[model samples]
Target: MLSGWEFIPFLTDYLGGDIHAPQEQFWFLNNFSDLVTSSFQNVCGGDVLNGRSLGILLIITLFVGWLFVKNDATNLLIYVLGVTLALCSTTFIDWTSLSHNELIMNTIGNIQFPFRLVPYAGLFLSVIASFVICNIIDGITSNNYKQILVIISFVLISVCGYFGTVQPALDRITQNVSEKYLKKTESKQTIPDDVVIDKYNYNAIFDYLTQTGETDYYSEKAYNNATSIINNIVYVNGKESKLIAEYKPNKIIYMIHAQKGDKIDLPVIAYKLTSVSDNGKKVKFNQSKRGTVEILARTNVNRIEVSYKPIVLYYVMMFIALLSWFGVIFYQVKNVKNRLIY
Candidate 1:
């Protein structure tokens, strides 16, 4: 039940007891191969919108609790937990998803992070839409047929939605990797990433990697040996002309590689370096191992944007609940007055 907060920071890093972890960079660089190699590549390979789903569930439960349970911490905890769930949700959205598609899929590039979780909110909206339709049906029709129809609408729409958007994304990830290698014109000429390594001092090797963000210009084996401390790492863009690290003892390198002609609003992860390489270029450092702490972000444009679908959806649900409660109060008042002797 309480296994989610493994990556949460030590609270001092954040402004309001909230820490920041860039998502797009964290997953792709740290665990891209997991998705690329997985048989069920989509859901089984990486992450799906569990946080969004939980957040939606959390909000719906809280609102329903208002109708059923007394106002108390027990119910309030559910609301708080929903908010927490969304925060965790951002970490895994761009992962492989057999449930979502044939390969892996990521969110749109141009949108902000706060809006990144829109699909989840849209989903929450659909859920709310179904609920609204159900209640309207019950109040106006009161027939068994109406209830059955409402049930169908709820299931058909929600399931179709998540699966439809997700499945295609998986297909793209699977294809992109294969199609890319197939078209490589410099098949023999291109620099190989793996080669024999010479035994040398490990510190010098680490220093070389620290400066250039790589061990060798034409060898993945060298790069892998140096970054053995990390669990996994993958190239964000296909390849680059020897990536170099600007500087740092500990820093997160945020980079995005979008499709050709695709729209993107890459977030400003760094203020020091103004312009970076785009899709045709290599701007972000690829991490071989997952960091002790990780930030999850969408690989978009120049502004930092994290998806907040759960939060927004909860707010909408809460607002509806407040209005409903007010209506209930007014109805009670009118009944009391009509019964009083005049």
Candidate 2:
């Protein structure tokens, strides 16, 4: 119910396509959106709250206290006010030296807009308003009349909330879904290979790389250099230079039948953690000008293995996390068994 009233202004703004920053004239609590926008100064004009909505909110907030003075609603009102004030405190603080206070600035900056506190304020006001109305209804002389009044009040509140909040949200969702579907149908062109997809699409890939410690050597310069080298590579006896063995996520063995003093370039990015072995003997690997891993294959050497070794710390941390989860599960199981037996 509180959310419904709090979001009504936002819903109206969204519907009207007037969701931009408030104008200079509408800044400074003169409008609802201005009241919600972060920052003390309203240099960028955007949406502002409606005057009628503000008036209604103010009247309810002021008048509800009078109704709740004789009841326990006062305590709840105070608690609500305290919480709301705490959430809003950053808005009034001097942020001119925010650069010096990185932690404080980051915490507040995460909020995106200070005006978000307005919904919270509206929420608390709604709570107080509900309490006031209920308290007034409780004071009726007849029990039957009081019950009827309560039921009527609940129905009215529910109806108002549904229409004011849920309906607008549902309408917006339907509209967005329809528009997106239309766009999908209209789009026919293929995405270019060079075009980067949204980061969220590849977040899992990044997470996997991080977990395996494979992201340490991810340098853009190295990748670009490797691509250039691969493009200009000349192969001798290409049929003999083939992958001999493959292991997903870590190791690859290649048979490079290169003559004496022949440099065989492997199809892998050059990294410090990569270990190269020639014909079962450890060999020093060099990087191509393009940054791809390459090795000098001796005349007798027939096979080469390129293995990626992750840092030991990655395994240690994984083991520790696993152990902690196991310990927690054991403790919970033991407690549950004890309770059941007792």
Candidate 3:
């Protein structure tokens, strides 16, 4: 969560608040069938589950109820959690109407997808389903009835796996192959020399500091007219300076020569988590209307580094998580050693 655009506060607000509505949709009765089998379909689409999938879910629900009756506490808890997750994930609420409420929209609407929690629900339900099948098989004393139950379970599982997972994955792979290779080769589209690629085309929310417009390159006029501290150009002593930029995941390094009073403009956008250093020493930086970073050289600056560094609290939490994971692994290893010795 501390990585990438998640660390940017304004970007988070723009994504969770401004653009969450289009992702919202209501769940239907057939959605439960889709949820149980992990059926892939657009939430906003009018697609309905087939009768066979629906029937499978109905049988699974019946088994869940039976497990509850038999006082199978573990499976019952798992089933309830699955249902709760399904209900909360854009399923029950009329978010289309609730989208007007700022608090509600920011909090619950942050999910951005109706099916965000559906996969977890499906996982829990799958565990319960397997447990229920085992229980049913164990309870059957007659060999003939046990064999029939086993065959039925196997058939149902195979059908569900094929339709829910394998077929959808195959279809996606075929579509991607056709679109990426076949379609491009067939069309033979050539790029125009005048056409400049917009790196921030897909990243609209990151431009909150700029608020240039819906489009990145098209909104340059707005940022250009604004009184931003930085410009799109690098300067040394009031003269434009050329620099080489090395991009990385967490940081960007610039190889530029600068004397005192030189204002260097970095290509990277300015965010709350962004930090700038001149020759490994922290430097004060200003944000442009276009969200670019500008720094005045105090000394002869050779190498400048701009990085996205999360706060101390993020590192503390990460340390705790790693420690906890190691503890669990050590305990499990000890238990395995003891079992082997016995």
TM-score of every model versus the real structure = 0.25, 0.34, 0.50
Per-residue error for 220 in candidate 3, Å, reads 18
What does the lDDT come to for candidate 1?
0.35
lDDT string, candidate 1, 1-342, tens digits: 122232222221223422232222222221322222231232311344222233233334424533433345553444345333333234334433322542222343212233244344334434443444555667765555555576578679768755744654455445545332322121122322222222322122222223222222212323334343221232333232222222222322334443443333222122212233433343432222321111222345422122111224344556666777788899977864664423
- How big is the positional error of residue 104 in model 1, measured in Å on the Cα after superposition? 34
Error of 3 at 189 (Å): 15
**In lDDT terms, how accurate is model 2?**
0.47
Q: Model 1, which residues run further than 4 Å from truth?
A: 1-112, 117-127, 174-177, 180-342
Query: What TM-score does prediction 3 earn?
Result: 0.50
Ranking by TM-score: 3, 2, 1
lDDT of each: 0.35, 0.47, 0.52
Cα lDDT, model 1, residue 41:
32
Task: Determine which window of 10 residues in candidate 1 has minimal summed lDDT.
Answer: 265-274
lDDT of each residue in 94-192, candidate 3, tens digit only: 545676777776677545555566566666767666676556665764464554567577789777654653454344335544233311122213322
Q: CA lDDT of 106 in candidate 3? A: 60
- List, residue by residue over 146-255, the lDDT tens digit for candidate 2: 55667587789767744653443344335545333312112223322122323333322221112222322334434445333322343333322323243334666666
Q: How big is the positional error of residue 85 in model 2, measured in Å on the Cα after superposition?
A: 24
